[model samples]
Target: MTTPNESPKDKPSSKQMICENESSTTKKNDEGDNVGGGVESVDGQNMSIDDANETGIDDPKGQGSSSRKRGSTIDVAIQIGSGSGSGSNARKKREMEIPRGEPTCYVCSKNFTSWKAVFGHLKSHQRETPGALPPPTFTPTEGSPENNNDDETNPREQLAPTLLNLALETMQKMSEDSNMSVVHRPSSAFNSPFWTTNSGAPVWNNNSSLTVGARAFFTKPGGANFDRERIPERVVHARGASAKGFFEVTHDISHLTCADFLRGPGVQTPLIGNFDLVGNNFPVFFIRDGMKFPDMVHALKPSPKSHIQENWRILDFFSHHPESLHMFTFLFDDIGILQDYRHMDGSGVHTYTLINKTGKEHYVKFHWKPTCGVKNLLEDEAITVGGANHSHATQDLSDSIAAGNYPEWKLFIQVMDPADEDRFDFDPLDVTKTWPEDILPLQPVGQMVLSKNIDNFFAENEQLAFCPSIIVPANAPKCVYHNNHHEGFMNFMHRDEEVNYFSSRFDPARHAEKYPIPTAICSGKRDKCIIEKENNFKQPGERYRSFAPDRQERFVKRWIEALSDPRVTYEIRSIWVSYWSQTDKSLGQKLSSCLSVRPSY
Candidate 1:
C-alpha cells in the first residue's frame, strides 16, 4: 500500500484493502488530498496483498514530481499469505508464504515488485494529480537531515533518498526505451521537448486524449502506429545500398525493342540502383534452374544446425549440381571479392526475350561496365579494407555522389535470334553459362550516372520496394499502365470508384496502347530434369586457362582452403576434385595433390 495505518474506508473501492486491528490516521498533502486515497496500515495484519495485485494506468509522459511532497507519511504495508503448518499434502503446499513487500504506489497505494515497473508506473501520474510525490532520484546532500538518525527526523525525510533513487532509475529506463545512444558529446546541444499527450496538441495532461490524436499507448488512438514502424524488407536482397541518378540512352536500340525508355538516343530515365545482388556479383550462379534458388541460399547462408557458414555444406550442395563449376571459376578467382560499388561490373545473368514493334523476339542479356573501369583489390588489400570497415563501399559511393564526383556505368546488351539457340555447344538459356562476347558482341545502349546521393536513408534504401506492376516512384514511365487488381494491404490510393478492374464500365479508365507480349508454340512435356546440353566443364576450363600463373595459384589456394574444412569428407572432396578435373585437368591435379583425395573423374 502507499502508506500503512491509515483509514481503510478512504481508499478507492478498486483496491479493496483489508485491514485488521489497526487504527490509521489518513495523511494529507498540503492541499489536503488523502495520500493513497486514505489507505491504512497495521503492524502484521494490514497485509497489502491487494496493493501488489491491483494497479492503475501507466503513463508514458513520466508524471510525478522530482521534488518530494511537503507533507507525506512513511507507512509500508507488506504481507505473505500463509496457512496452517500441518495438514494434507495440498494444504501443506498452501501453507508456504512468500513475502511481497516491494515498493507501494504513493499515488494510489498500489504495490509493485520491480522498482523499474514502479518508476514506469509513476509515469502515469501528472504533476497536478493528488498524492503523486513519485519516487525520488537521489539522496539528500550529506549535510541534510536525511543523513541523520531515523528517530531524529520524520519518515518524510527518510523517504527522500528512496524517492530520489527511483526517479534516477526511471529516467535511465526512459533513456533506454527511447533507443537513444548514451554517448556524451561536448558539441551536442540537444534536449528533449515536452511530451505531447492529446494528439499533436502539445499539452501537460497525462489522462487526456484526443479522439484521433497522440495519446498513451493503451489508449484507442495513440502511439499504436509507431509500434509498427518497420517497413518490410526484401527476402533475398535484404542488405542493400542505393542512390538516385539517371540512366541516359547512349545509342539507338529502337530497332531491337519497342520499350519507351530505350526508344531513342539521349533519353534519360530516373533510376534507383540497389546492388546487393549476391548472385549478380559474379554474372553467373551455382545452379541453372531458378527452382534451385532456395537450396542455393540455404547452402550459402549459415547451417541450420551450427549457424555458421560451413564450406562442407556448400561443397556438398554443389556436388549434386555439377553445373555450378562454371560459376566457381569467378567465385574462387582473384577478383571474386569486389573492391567497392563504383568499380564493379554487372550482368542480367538470365536470358530474357525482348520483343520488337513487329513482334520479332530476340533473347537478350544486359551488361553493366563501369565507366571508371574495372578495379579489384588483392586478397590482402581486401582483407585490410573489410577489417577496417564493412560498409566501406556504401560510404565510398555515397561520398562520391555527395562530392559531385558521380560514378557512371555504360549499359550494353547482347542479342541472339531464337533460331540460333540450338547451334551453341552450351545451353544459352543456362544462367551458369555466359554468352561469348566475341560471337555475340555487346552493343552499347546507355550510360547510367549516379549523380545524387540519397536524402533519406530509410526511405531510399530500407523502404525501397519492387513490384512487377510498379516501377520506382516519381520516375516517369513513358508507357502508362494501371494496377487493375487494386486495393489490398498498404493500398494508399485515393479513388472514389467502387470498382478497380480492367475494362470496367462502372469506373472507366483509359487503356494504353497494346504492347507486344512474347509467346511461343510449345510441344514439350513439363518435366524436372537437367537441360540436355549441360556442358558444365568447357566454360570453367576456358576461364581457368585464361588466368595468369599466380592467379591460377591463388584460385587453387582458395579451393584448398575451402576443402580443408574438417567436415568436408573424402567423398565430397573427391566430388569437388572431379568437377575441377572436368573443368581443368591441371586445376584438378593441384586440388588432389593438396587435399590428398582421389579424383572422382
Candidate 2:
C-alpha cells in the first residue's frame, strides 16, 4: 500500500541494514494476491514472500529492517524481488541485534566485547597438557580467599628432597636396626695418599724443586713436577658445569631397552650431569656426523698462532660444510643467546642404542626438558648480563642450589624400533638432526634434581666428567662396544708394557706375572656401529615452516644477513643456497633474492 518513493522513518538505521536491496526487490505470490513480496534470482530460483519473511529476509521486522536500527548487528541478510502483480508489493526487512556491554569469558572470566577476543583470552587460560601449571598470573588480592589459603600453606614444605636428607634417612634407619651394626668398608690402603712420581714413590719435598745449590749454583733442573699440576681439558665441551643428581625410572620401558635405569619405577641411578651451551641455547651443532667433530672444533678454536678467537676465520671454515645448515638455523635463532644456565634445555645431541634382553637394539635420543619451561634472553640481554657478570650462569646455578631452589629437568627419550627406523623421515642417529616431537613422541623417564650445591667447586664441579659412552644396567644398549673394546685392549697392552719396565723396587707386579689382557672379537652384527636409518632434513624444514608467517620472514632475513657477510665466499654461498633449497624452496628463494642474484648451484 506504500508508494515506492516514500521512505519509512520507523525503519532501522543504515548501520543495522542487513540487506541493501530489500526495498527494491518486492513481488506477489502464486495466489495472484500480493503477500508482502517474493525474491527471484537471475538464475530463476525464487522464494515466496511468506518464506522470506519467516527467514527474516523480506519481513520488515526481520534482519534486513532491524539491521538499520540504532543498535543492531547482522552478519547475513536476504531480499524478495518484486514480481508482476496487481500492484507492486513492498519489500520486507529485518536486522539482528548485537548485545551491548562486555561479555564475560567462560574460561578465564575475562571481559571481552567480541567472541574472537574472548576465544584468544581462553587460549592463555588453558594449562599445559602435561599437567604442569604455569606461574600464577596475579598476586592474591588483599585479604582474598587465595591470600588466606596461602597463609596456611608453608613455602618451605614444598622444597625438593636434598642429599643431606637422603643420607640422614639412610643413617637413621640403619641406626634403628641392631642387626645392621657390622659393615665392611673398602681397604684404606687403596685410598692411601702418597706423594709419588708417575710411578709409586714417596717424594718429600715437592714445593722446592731439585736445584744444584741453594745460593751459589742455582740451576733450573727438572720440569716434571710443574707438568703434573695441570691436566688436559676435554676435547669438546671444554667449558661446562657438572652437578650430581639421580635419574629415576618413570615408565616401564624394559621391553624396548635392556638398560638397568629403565627397568622399573622407583629405581634410581646416581648420575653426574654436565651442560655446555654448545655456543648457543638451541642444540643445532656445526656438523651432522661425529666424524666432523674434531674438524669443527679445530676450526672454531682460537688460531694456534695467536690464541685468539676470530669469527671471520671460523665462519670461513664452516662455510664449506653445507650440511651444517640445519644446525645453523637453530644456532642463529632467538634461543641462541641464553641469559643463564637455568633457562635453557639440554640435549644428548647424539643417537645411542637401547638394547633389550633379546639383544634387539633400538635407536634412541635423550632430551632434558626444564621444569621451568624453555626461555631464552634476547641478544641485548645476553650482552648486558655478560658485561655485568661473565660467570653469570655459573653463579646463578650455584646460588640457586645453595638457596634450596633446586633446578629440575625432566628426562625424555624418543625411541625408534629397529624395524621402523628405515621408514622415518629423518636419520635418527644423525647428531645434527632433531626428531620431530609430533611424530616420535617423547616418553617420560623420571627426573633429575640438583638439590645440593657442591662443597668444593674444584673437586666436584670442575673435575667431574661425563661421557656419552658410559652406560649402566643391562637394558641400555652399547652402540660403540666393538670400537670401545678394541681401544680398551690396545690401552691395556700399552699400560702393561709400561708397568713391566717402570715398576719401583717395592712393586708387587715385578715378582708376579702380568695381569690377564682382554681380547676383542668381531661378531659381524649388522646393527652394531651402523648409523640410524632415516632422513635428516624433514624436521629442520618443518621447524622453519612452523614459525608464524612474520617469524618466518625474520628468520629468512637473519639467515641472509649472516650469509651476506663480505667474508662469506661465493662458493660457500652457492653451497648454502643449495642446502637451504633442499630443506625448503621458498627459504632458498628468499635468501637468493636478498643476495640479488640467482645461486649458480
Candidate 3:
C-alpha cells in the first residue's frame, strides 16, 4: 500500500492495472453463495474485484463519491478508501438472487434479493394507508397479514438507511461484481403480460367481473369503463357526411394554374395538392379579417349562460359588421335551408391567386356545382324533417352511396388578370363579393364523384385540407426557403441571412442565385389596415334585387324574426336596418316596416 506522502507518479505498480489470473477469479465464500463475484470492468480499472473488496481501500472523494475513471477502455478503479462500518456490512450482503423466504415489500409484498433495490422500490408505493387491494401477482398467492398489518419493525425500515447508503455508494462504483446497481430485474420482464395503467403498473385479474373469490369488485382497470361509456358528441361539425372519390380533369386548364397535380388529367391522388377554396353553400364569408374569426365564433355559438344559439346574439354581433350583409342575403333566401348535401352548390368565396408555369399570376375564385342540381326546404318542412333526424343529411348521403347511387359535382374556376384588377367595380380581393359569372365566366376544370362511402366513421378526420399554400414565418418548423415577399396574411420573413444554407462560418455569404419575382411589388412597414375599397353595399344590393318577389318576402320575414328577439336591443336593430338600407333601398324599407309591427318572441 502507498503511504500518504508517496506521489501517484512514484507508484508505477499501482498506476498500470493488469487483468486477473484464474486463481483470483470468482469463488463462493464460507456462506456457500457467490459472495464476491467476477465481473468485466465497465471502465477497466480493477480486474481482481473480490480481493479488493475483502481488504479495504482509500478514496479521494471521501465516501460514496468515487466513480471509475472513464477513458478509452473500460476499467474498474480500486476505490482506495477505509469505508464506514454500516456501508462495509451492506456491501458484504450484496446479492443477485432471491431464494424462497426473502425480504418482502411492506405494500405489495414483492420479494427482493438486494436490500438497496427494496429501498428504491418502496418509492413507487404510497406512504398513506391503502385499501384491501389485490396483489396483482400472476399466481393466486395470499399475502401474510403480519408482513403488512403487524406493529413489528419493517424489514425494509430497520435495514433501510444502510441499504440507502449502500445504494448511494454502489452507484459510486461501476463493477457488477460487487454492486447490484449494474443488475436489474423489472417486474414486467418476468411477470405475466397484460395491459397496464398510465403509470405502467400491471393488472393480472383483467376480466374485471370474474374474481378468485367474490372480493374483487372494481380492481384497477378491470371494470366497466363508465368514464368513456359513450364518446362525448363532437363539439363542431356534429352532423356531417363524408365520402371518398377522386377529382378527374374534364377539361385541360393547365395554362391557368402552376400545380402539376392539377396539370394531369387522370385518377392519380395529388397529396402536395396546390389549391383548395374552403366554402359553404354561400359564395361569401361574413367576416373580412381572419383575426375576427375567434370572436365571431364566440358570439355565434350557443350563449355561455343560456346554452342555446339565440338569433338576437347573432344579429347584435353581426350588425356591426356590414361586410356580413352579403351572407345574410343568402341565409334569408328560400335556398338557405339546404335539403341535402348532394344537391348543394358550393362556392369558394375568397379571392385566391393562380400562377401559370410561365410565372404569369391571375386572381381566381372556385365553384362546385352539383350535377344532381339544387334542392331546398321551406321553414315548415325543415323543422318537421330535421326534428325527426338531426343527422338526416349525413345518413341520407351514406344511404344513397350504399344503394349504388352516387353524387357528383362539377368544379369550375373564374380567372381574372392582376393587371385588370382595377377594371372591376367591386373589390376582387374582398371575400364578401363574388366575381360576375357573366363577364369572368365559369371555366370548367374537373368533376368530383362520390363512388364509395367512408369505411370507418370514427377514423382520423384527415379530410381534404384546402387553403392558401402560405403560412406565417413565426409558425415555421424550419427556415422558409422561398423569399419573394409576396402578398400573404402573415408575410413577415425577417431574416439576417441572404443565403440560408450555403455559408461559411467565419465569412458571411453574399453570393445568391437571383430569380425573377412577381411584378406585383410589396412596399410598406406592415400595420393594421382595412382593404382600401370595402364596397360592402353593391353585391348585397345586386343579389337582393335578383331574387324573386316571393323569395324577397321570405328574406324580409326572416330578418324581422331575427330582429324581434327580446334580447335584440334597439341600438342593434337600428344598426342592422341602416346596414340593410345601404344594401338595397326597397328591401331595407320592407325589413324596417315589418320589424316595427312584429311582436317580440
TM-score of each: 0.60, 0.50, 0.54
Question: What are the Cα lDDT values of the candidates?
Answer: 0.62, 0.52, 0.58
lDDT (10s digit) by residue, model 1, range 121-217: 6656633443335453443544235365443222322332444343433233323332222322212322237654344455454322222211111
Comparing 1 with 2 on TM-score, the higher-scoring candidate is 1
Predictions: Cα RMSD each: 18.1, 36.9, 22.4
For TM-score, candidate 2 versus 3, the one ahead is 3
Which stretches of candidate 2 lie above 4 Å from their native place?
A: 1-233, 273-284, 305-308, 468-537
TM-score of 2: 0.50
User: Per-residue CA lDDT of candidate 2, range 1-601, in tens?
Assistant: 1236545564332112111222333443321111232221211112222222322222222334322212212221233223222232444343322112232343345555433344334334432232222332333334333344433222211111121122123333333433333432223323348565545566664433233332112222233343232356655555666555677777788887665567888888665422221224455566654434445677777876788766556667676665566776676666666666777787877666667776667777778888888777766787888889888888898899888888888878888775676676555555667777788899987788887666666666555433344432222332322221324411322222222333455443434434323232333322213233434456568778877887787677777777777777776677667677778888889877777656656
Worst 10 residues of 1 by lDDT: 91-100
Q: Which candidate has the top score in TM-score?
A: 1
Q: How high a TM-score does candidate 3 get? A: 0.54
Candidates 1 and 3: which is better by lDDT?
1
Give per-residue lDDT, candidate 1, residue 438: 96
Off by over 4 Å in 3: 1-236, 264-276, 460-520, 597-601
